[model samples]
Target: MASLKERITRLQSSALFRGMTRESLEPLAKILNEESHKAGTVLMDMNAPGDKVYIIEKGRVRVSRVTSYGEETTLQELTAGDIVGELAPLDGHMRSAKVTVTEDAVMFAVSGEEFEQLLKSNHDVSYNLLRELGDRLRRANDNIISRLEEQRVNIEGRMLRLHKLTEASKSINSTLDLDKLLTRILEAATSSLDADRGTVYLVDDIKKELWSKVLQGSNMAEIRLPIGKGIAGVVAETGETINIPDVYQDKRFNRDFDKKTGYRTRSMLCMPMKNKDGKIIGVFQLLNRTDGAFTKDDEEFIDALSAHASVAVENARVAQEMVQNERLSAIGRMASTIIHDIKNPMSTLRVYAQVMKRKSGNEEAGKLADEMIHQVDRFVNMTQEILDFTKGVSSLNIVDLEFGEIMNSVLDFIQQDLEKHNVKLLRETQFKGMVKMDQDKMVRVFYNIASNARDAMPNGGSLTVRTNEAKGYVNIEFVDSGTGMPDEVKKRIFEPFMTYGKKHGTGLGMAIVKKVVDDHKGRIEIDSEMGKGTTIRILLPAA
Candidate 1:
């Protein structure tokens, strides 16, 4: 919008035209190209051929170069009266750096031929342009040096972290203690990546959850979450690594733990650990990296570490299995010898109890003998259970029996135990029907349940025993008012060698109980809650 006279005055103000009078500037200003640019516009790209020189009459533009890592380092900023792309045209080479508009600006441009002729004719204009180019060259050199030094430091830091990971991998494979192994894996991760806190969750397929146990001070905490429920859980389920620069920005992130613990979480990285077969076995979660958010480099480092950790975990498991197998071998031999030695005495007692029952018929003595015979048989069966368990063998003699007959014997036998533990037994045995089952094995099922309930209620509680018939099935349910199981134990309650809160517990009671029910074509269902109680219901086919 400027008039011809105004444009002449503006040209007169430029240092490049400092020595020119209005007569000399007027003809030049009329031919010079005028251009305008918005902020962030790239006026000159690095190494691109330049055909004209630009003089900024307004606004500012940054000159920068991209580093090897794709980071841009600013070399200089030019505002009004500064010239750019002049050196490249004068020297007959490509532009050395990129020029970007930092703000909206109008510029005056001169073709390379006109610029050269003007510089040649005017000494002051040439001298001023030389001074500005010298200053830019010096600053550009300094910026390049600084950027190179930064890249060197970054490379060295990465090398150090990789070295730490390599050494940790060596120690990890040799560690056989699973708790110690878990500790080592997490320690290496947090320290190597500069993370604030972390956890390693092993997947429990039977429970369909990602679970971990941590010892905080003197207490051990067991945490469990469903697969695909949270970030880490989803990583485990999908076998992918999830890196969130800002946890608060991610809707999938749960901030409740941070709120409760008063920990400010800024970032998170979760990786899935897989076994040799490519099956995901565990998940690793790292929270709040000390260096700010986790980066792509961090993810790469963690991915390598997770692979090493997976092998270490699997190796520890294999080593444990070897030890356990050896232990069971020893237990099996001792049990076999003991069972052989006790068989003769057990048979003799059985014969005597039967004879006493037959001889004392029609008297009170006969009833006591009958009870004694049943007690002897039960003791024999109990001993056989241990031997059979060690040998991994089981046999059942199925028969038709009534619920009333079973409950009557169970109540009579468990009454002494219930009184000893101060656990009162409430019965609802109104329903009666024939259930197809093994008499001895069925008795073992009820006995194991009573024993487990007694152990659960150390201080004194009530155990309710009820029986019913529905849909051609007889149900025997035992509900105990005792301390319930945690999720970890409740999930695998039927698995062998799983026990809780017992000093001399064999951990085989529930395993045997479930086996007995399974063998008789019946099923056992259990429901337990912490600080409340447990309910165990057994269903058997009715005759």
Candidate 2:
């Protein structure tokens, strides 16, 4: 125990006691006892009676709790000029924690009874403690509120970005043009994420290559990279998203693109473009975030853009395929017409050689006579058809003939052929008027249609040729109980070499009839239904 004067000297040196005026602190200072503690000495055992309050005068004291593992974690370390055990003095409760002197320490201690008596008398001291407690509580509350507000802002920002991305994906899926769709993707991606640069690469899986389709930024056109060689390639190969805060330090970053474009890379975000099947179609790479490096929000938005791009690219390919089909159909028709012309002349030459061989006898006159007859026979059979085709009805002598007379000539030529096949012909010739037209072309038209009618009724069916006059025109109709056509076939029937019954045609007969009719300023209509029958109606002007 020390004298009251010595105790006062120690207390006066302490910050806790110094907060009071010299006269006011004098009483509490004299009541305090100076106690010396050694290292490893327990100052207070947990849950023990709280008798005294302590003010550390020298050395240090540690306040700690025993953890579940029986290890001690120091909550606070009190050094000289520090106050402890003050909270315990406010209430006569068992100590909630144990206190130990970590090093040799000298502290001034006062009893809880003395603390209570001093608290009742010193209103100014009590008021100061109350204010300190209130300040700590208010500060704790403010800290909690600030953290919660920050969390809420983060959540809201993510939701807004998600909604915009969903809307953009929907818009991109609605178009089929590759260029337009890719342009929309760039605009939507950059705007949605508030990114500074964006580019979409279309993957050529077959070639194992990635090609840029749309590139946009402040100076985005400057950057270019090859597949399997850069950040874009990593994302494309692994089908993962990559975000690098600093491209300069990353070993995976290739500087060739920077060297070529003269654009330095600071940060990069890249994602793989995948189709519905999770097949990597391409890559989308963004460079140098304007504000800060791209975060998780940017990786998510790039994924959305890539998904929509895959569908758009597929649709464009389908449109291109359809166009190609139409072009091929046209070419087939032209080839068939050329073949028909060449074959006719060859047939005439073969016939002439056969005829000449049959007429040949031994040597001179007999052989000459035989050769002349054979050559004439061959010439008649071969050149006859070729001559008729090349020198069409336009060069034939014109004649004023009744429409029924032309129909009867064509009907007569096919009558025997039809009877042999057990086919029926129903002729309803109503036109009795005359028309000035090429007689040969008119014969060719009727002959070709009648012949086609015979071929169509392979199992022997009815054929009807009906004639009528309507609106200053003569109309002739051919109805055959033959396999009809679908809409697609019907539209293309007039096109040369477009044939349905493959085993029975060179596909040129109807085409020839169509051309002749067209040349004569005639209109022809065909109506047919699959498995039902076909009706061919030819209309010509009446003179």
Candidate 3:
């Protein structure tokens, strides 16, 4: 058993009671009741009224509850620096859990009446205990509420999926066109599953391969994958839903992909994409579910999502085939017209050149004829560009493209024009990365933007071109210190018929720029202030 002086010393040592003035706890010290109990003695029982609370001075006590079946569950074991029975006194309720002596224990007990008397005299101690009790209750309640909210959110998500699937089914049944159907399917799959990124991979069962057919995401730039690899491969081989909460931690996750692109794989939920006959046609993988792991609810939702997607993909394929046939017919007609137009002009130019060579009398006439021929050639090139732009003929021919090298070529191509216009070209080529793209198409995208900058700064202000790496993408910035466009002009700058200056300009340059960016699966952002300058920012995926 602890002596009165020893009990006082123990209480004084605790951080909770040490801050009180000596005068404030004088009554508590003088009236402190020291009691000793053997091990296994019940100090406080469950359902008992709370009249007194105990502060352990020495040894230990087990606070526990006995169930109806006589099983004991220990709530807490009280040792030195421990207080029990505060919960009930603070709430004016019965003791909730039993406190028993687990070891020979010495304690100081304070009755409710004495505690009230102490509180009336020592307001600081009373207020401090009240605050601590209140904080504990509030924290417990907050934890309960947070868990309830999570459950409610999960339930609501399931209901929303059912509603979305109903609408998606109706839309899928009504669509037969392949491109439009694919767009709808991807949009639905992305939304219904609540995934940050969703992709449809067509499986060639014979070849045992998976190829990305369609993808959608807020941050999605481009898709590059081969079959029999990674999470998608797991789905393909097992024909089961593979829910990988952390792909990076999974031993089966192929890091070869991360090596290829500088992007890391996080979470993935992959399921087999099947057709109407329940035949596995491909694998569908969704990455980084926005909320958490693809829960049971998500799996159900994705099952429905995949059902609609599979049908739409097949229908779209058929529709696309038909569209291709029609496109070929139209191209054949356009080719004939182009041949006639091109050959007739070339024949006349050849005849004129021969006449000039044979006659050799009028030098000015010959010079004028030669200049006219050159103009005709330029017109032909411009016509071809217009044809390519209007037809949306993206170059499928891929090459290892060094971005800095191509940017240098573009800068060189526009250097002479910049000199003619007295524009100071500034190049900040900090990026040294590569991409798989068509060289011609990439050059065209840059050329269009740079040329527009030159035209904007005709009076010889500086034009700045910069390149750098961004969040999983490469960014190129083109800034021109020109008489910037007004809000009205800037609003329509990318339109096919919008031109800021030069009466003879075709106004298709920016429009073509937009097309090239779309072809590269990239984004363009334009920022301009009237009378300040304009900046065009382009973001493309890095290889």
Q: TM-score of each candidate? A: 0.74, 0.40, 0.35
**Candidate 2 lDDT tens digits, 1-543:** 767666667766665554667678778877778789999999997888888888787898888778789987655667887667767667768887789999998888888888878778988667765664565458557856775797799889878877887888777877777667767777787777666776877776655767654334432232334567777877777887888889888999889868998988788888887889988876777777888799886776677667667777777768755654444444444444544565666556656655555665545655555545544444343334333433342344456677776677668767867999888989888997977566666666776777777777789898898888989888889898987766656766876566776576546567667776777778989998877888899888888
Q: Give the C-alpha lDDT of model 1.
A: 0.85
Clashes of 3: 2
lDDT of 3 at 187: 67
Candidate 3 C-alpha lDDT tens digits along 333-404: 565478567877776886787677558778887776665665466455445555665565655456667888
What is the alpha-carbon lDDT for the whole of candidate 3? Answer: 0.73
Task: Work out how many backbone clashes candidate 2 has.
Answer: 6
lDDT of each structure?
0.85, 0.72, 0.73
Best by TM-score: 1
TM-score of candidate 1 on Cα atoms, chains taken together: 0.74
Per-candidate clashes, comma-separated: 0, 6, 2
Task: Determine which window of 10 residues in candidate 2 has minimal summed lDDT.
Answer: 215-224
lDDT (tens digit, per residue) of candidate 1 on 384-461: 777787667989888777778778878887977899889999988877778788888888889889888888899999
